[model samples]
Each structure stands twice: as structure tokens, then as C-alpha cells.
Target: MRWFRKKSASTTKTIFGEYCATSSVHGVRYFSDPERTLCEKFWWIVMFLVSVGGCVKLIESTWLKWNLTPIVVNFENQPISVTEIPFPSFTICPPGKISKLMYNFAKEAKQIRNSGAHANAYGSEDCFSTEFE
Candidate 1:
């Protein structure tokens, strides 16, 4: 701590000290490098805050992209088995909508079957696979 003193009894002050004493302590004159002082004072504070914010944003973006994004993957394109989901014990509502949907699917499937090989050769809308439906 003693060694950190600006001046010792025997040592003479250098030009830098004389400049500091004249301009900073006694004189009203200021240095031209205002931005240097501003940066020196605020650099670490700004950089640390920005880095912390960036890390938080990075974590948030990763979570959104991976977990929050709604991905509608086609089961036919992948090798993953589709039988893993646990069936609900009870229906949330009446089963009329389900029965109607099944009836429509059966009717459409029957129509496809009735429209035979002639339908496939001349690519009509009726000839398309049930996947299009």
C-alpha cells in the first residue's frame, strides 16, 4: 500500500504527474480523449450485461426451437412406431364427431376401391390415394 503512493519524499514527480496536477487538480483544461475515459469507465459494465443478456436469449431461443415449436411430422416418412401414445380413459365430449369421421373415411375408401385400374392410367382427382384426402 505504501508503494502505491503517487510521490515519495526523495523522488521527483514526472511530466505525467505534472500534467495531471496542472490539468486535473489546478487547471480547468481537459483532455481531448473524452470517449476513451467513457469507454474505460463503462466497458466492463456494458459488456458483462450484454453477454448475460445474450446467454439468456440463447437459452430461450434454443428452448423455443426445440420444445415449443409445433412440429407436424408425417409418420409414413419415418421409421418411428406410432403405437406409443397412451389411449385416453374417457372421451372429452360425445363420440358423434368420431363416428361421422369414420363413416366419411369408409365411404371415400369404398369409392376409391370402386374406381379401379382405369382411374390410375389417366390421372384424375378420383384416382389419387387416400393420403391426399
Candidate 2:
């Protein structure tokens, strides 16, 4: 009886040579290649920078739109009286006063939305929509 069988050429090349060779399968080679890995990392960094820049530009534009069109309120029309209160407590205004405050805010918002510069900056007339009507 033969105790150990002879190694076959086909099995030897397929198992040992392919597995232990410097180059691997196509998928593994693509990922393991240093140049390809560096390229991928470079693209990832570029995409990150682009996204951050886009966000910054959006925030800056919005700020500029708001700053350019100031909200000028007539304090005489809706007077706000401040009342001092005790420590650890707060003073509450009447319901009418709160309603007036909300109405004033809505009016100013409508004016800003109707302004040509602000409307054009936002690219839409209903950008700052409020249900305070």
C-alpha cells in the first residue's frame, strides 16, 4: 500500500504558486496596488473639501441675504415694556403683547421676502415661508 501520494503538477501550481506569488487575483491586486490606493485616497480628500466648501458657501450666501436686507421695526407701533422680577423668576407679558410680537415678526419676514435683492439671492420667493398669517 502507498503511504503518501505524489504531488500533482496542476494542483501544486494552482494552490502553492498562485497563493504565494507576488501578484494576486484581479480584485485583490486592484485594492492592494499602492498607486491605486493613493489615487483613491486623493479623490476622497478632494470630495471632502468640495463638500465642505459648498456648505460654507451656502451658509455665507444665506447670511449675506439676511444682513443686506435689515428688518426695521417700528417700536412705537408695538411697544414692549420690560418688567423686573424677583430672583429665579421671570416676568410674563400679556397674550396681546405676544401676539403683537409674532405679527411684527411675520410682517418683517414678508417684507424681506418681497424685496428684490433678498428674493434673488435666495432664488425663490417662498424661501423664508412663515405660517404666522
Candidate 3:
């Protein structure tokens, strides 16, 4: 009983300390990001949305990129080159594995996806269909 009491007290202190040190709401730490970075925050958001899948498509309809590329100048409109967009930005990750740079890359990728840089980018319905199918 004495050992149990000591163990519980220590565990409680550890958890409370962590919560106090981080930004949290409702006793739930939203961002445990010890090393703050724009990319990490963005990726957190991306991962959250992607987990919902359908809602992510609705919240940010341009997050999905099924082999989508960036756009550059074209015959009529000389837009940015979709094919030449940098790496790590235009790709999705397998959750909790996203890096800050990859999140940055994903942002640009999402923009390109929205801009129809790829002639065959997946639509909302199409994207959901593929995910489950």
C-alpha cells in the first residue's frame, strides 16, 4: 500500500507537470510540440484532418494529392510548374511520422492540388472512393 501510494503520487506529478508545461485545454494537451515549428503545427492539423478523411476533404478540399503535380507555364497560361514543385510538400504521410519540412511540402502540394495542376487530380468523391475502395 505504501509503494502504491508513492507510485501514484509520482505518476500524477509527471502528468500534471507535462500538462502545465504545454499549452492545453480541458486538461487535454492539444499541442505537445516541445520544439515549435510552423511545419509541425501544420502537419498536426493535416494529420488530424486526414484521420477524418471525409471531413478533411470538406474542411480543406485541396489536401489530397493522388499523384498530383504542380503546374508551371503552359500553352495558354504560364503558371508555375506543377511537376517541378519541391519534394516532401506534395506528399502524405502515414500519420505521426510527418516532419516539419514534409508538412511544409504538403502545404504547397495541397495548393497545387487545388489549382488543378494535375489534369487528373482526384476529386472529393473520387478521393474518398479510392481511400475505402
Summed backbone clashes in each candidate are: 0, 0, 11
Per-residue lDDT for 1-133 in model 3, tens only?
9999999999997886587457444323433445657676567666766667976666564544433543344564555556655565576667678676754655565565556654465544333232111
**Global lDDT of model 2:** 0.60
Better of 1 and 3 by lDDT: 3
Residue-by-residue lDDT tens digits, candidate 2, 18-109: 55345543343333335566787566556666778999999999999878864444346564333322236788878765666555677776
> In terms of TM-score, which candidate is strongest?
2
TM-score of each: 0.25, 0.29, 0.21
* Model 1 superposed RMSD (Cα): 20.1
> Which is better, 1 or 3, measured by TM-score?
1
User: What's the candidate order when arranged by decreasing TM-score?
Assistant: 2, 1, 3
Q: After superposition, how far is residue 125 of candidate 3 from its true place, in Å?
A: 64
CA error at residue 41 for candidate 2, angstroms: 0.4
Pick the winner on lDDT between candidates 2 and 3: 2
Q: Which portions of model 2 miss their true places by more than 4 Å?
A: 1-36, 71-133
**Per-residue C-alpha lDDT of model 1 across residues 1-133, encoded as one tens digit per residue:** 5775645632444544456446643221222233347555366446656778999999989988977654445446564433554455974866655666555666665566566753776666455545524
Q: Global CA lDDT of candidate 1, please?
A: 0.55
